[model samples]
Target: MDPTDTAVMIENYEAFRSEISLSKEDVIRELFRQNQDRISIKKEATAVRNLIRIIDSTLRLANSKGFHAMTLRDLCADSGLSMGGLYAYIRNKDDLIHLIQNHGFIITRRTLLHYTRDVPDVRDRLYAAIKAHLYLSELMRAWFYFSYMEAKSLPPQEKRDAVAIEREIEAIFLGVIEAGIDAGVYQPRNARLVSSMIKALLQDWYLKRRKYLDQNVPVDDYAMFVRDVVESYLLQA
Candidate 1:
């Protein structure tokens, strides 16, 4: 699904807020000014929210198997919504795939934003980003795994957007590496390559968590392992 379609829906939903007697006229006017249309923003927002829920539930089910293994009937059952209702939110399975990919990016961006806020030093920011990313994956393990693995199946435009979001995330890691080098904290090397490696290490925990658990690895221990590797590789001499 095109993100703009969702955006337009959200804008329309916002416009619907004016129906409430308590809704401020000024607020509604501002929304109209920004959107240039008094569309049913409330309904659109609700539909978008439902769409996200559908994506989340479907991905959770798909993680046990794979995307191709999941049917629309499976999604309908998993999401606890009828086929008609589900279709109202999305055109088809392909649309749902796009929604899930975009939703993952939205969630990841929100998580990183919280971690990076108010952190001045680049090293601290990087630490916070890593911790946030790992913690979020642990908390939303199925969703993260589904997003990572199912991305390849998205349509060309959706795939490009997904890759762009992934690259942006890697750039955050690269920024830290570059900072470390500039501050004489890290050895001169390819920051992008190092960033990719760091991401792999972080992702491997959730993706292959069974292996780690079989070895009796605790979360704190896993986090410490990441910190140690990063510090050893990136810290100043």
Candidate 2:
């Protein structure tokens, strides 16, 4: 099970993306269907469908205009939902941001854990983690973009939660590196520190994608490059 040098199917991010293929409607329903108390949105099929429209529109508008600059009226107009309907989803702008952030975290965290949970080898696990994260960020670029840029605007507790989420992701990478070290597949190093570096590189993929995209770097290319560099560093004598 030593994936340190042997050939294996290191497919593109698209392969990871396909494993968690979810439609827009499904995301909305899955996010809001549980918050009956917090969100007044009805649970009917059409209502759940419209909730997706509302979330999609809110994110779009919030991304275009700063979340602070986006008003309830703008959300209503963009989402094609009246104030009453919008209120059912969120009480105010703060609530709106909370809803969006929570939903994004749930999906991102779940996807990462699911795809990386079964990797038998630490090297393969690391590769899958990197590819899953990069592809998820690519597929939900707007969510990642909004979360990063607008994070400071969130309330103190919410901001803490955001940081915690980031650390949790880093911990996943840390676990894989530690496991590799334990199995003598990777050279010893500070696993946590190394994981943080890996997380930083992965974050840059979503944060400064324009720079990479300008150079015509594709996700698969970036994923493989990351895998190569990380594996090379880990396997050093």
Candidate 3:
């Protein structure tokens, strides 16, 4: 995008943030639905409510006490599910890790693509990308926080896929930058590097959320800050 061809401030997050795009209950149900074949106790464990209970408990525990250190017993206790019930959904911690990662990827990738696809202006698309990511992270705080904090704790193959998930995420932004460049709207630069930089800035929202929360900074405010900084940098000659 030619930075000069498009210069717009993003004032509305509704275009990027939607309540109906995906729901928590749907996410929980999807997890159980997709992995039911792998789950041995699937027949008796088809309750969406119970499945959600397990997922909620797992993420809460993982966020509080590191995904690596949290035990099945601990998850059961926090989630109010018996160890037997827990085993029905997951074979072990690694499976739990993959499950949470799955939730994060499904919601984030879908939301990002859904919101940005309709935006024609590279500036708006870039702006929507930044805001969409931040809002999604804000909405999926537990999963996003847990995913960022414990990505390395994942087992070998899951860890690699996790990293690739992050890259694909950044590629969403990279695609926008390349689009801008192709259209002669954005000033030329290393689009990949710029995309990574944007990812870094957006990641700070969830990584350092407490700092922003302590200062009473809202998601929209931070999104605007990052969007402005990124647009200015890209617009620079």
Point to the candidate with the largest TM-score: 2
Highest lDDT against the true fold, candidate: 2
Stretches of candidate 2 off by over 4 Å are: 1-10, 23-26
lDDT of 2 by residue, 134-166 (tens): 888898888898999988889887798899999
- TM-score preference between candidates 1 and 3, better one: 3
lDDT (tens digit, per residue) of candidate 1 on 1-237: 221221111112123223222322222233233332322234645554455567667877788768888888888988888888776656677776665665566656655664565566766777766776776677667878887786777788878987899899888788877987898768887889888988999999989999999999866567667767887877645
lDDT of 2: 0.80
**How far in Å is the alpha carbon of 124 misplaced in model 2?**
0.6
Sorted by TM-score (best first), the order is 2, 3, 1
By summed lDDT, the worst window of 10 consecutive residues in model 2 runs over: 1-10
TM-scores, all candidates, are 0.77, 0.90, 0.87
lDDT of 1 at 177: 78
**At residue 54, what lDDT does model 2 achieve?**
70
Q: For model 2, state the Cα shift of residue 37 in Å.
A: 0.9
Model 3, runs deviating above 4 Å: 1-22, 41-45
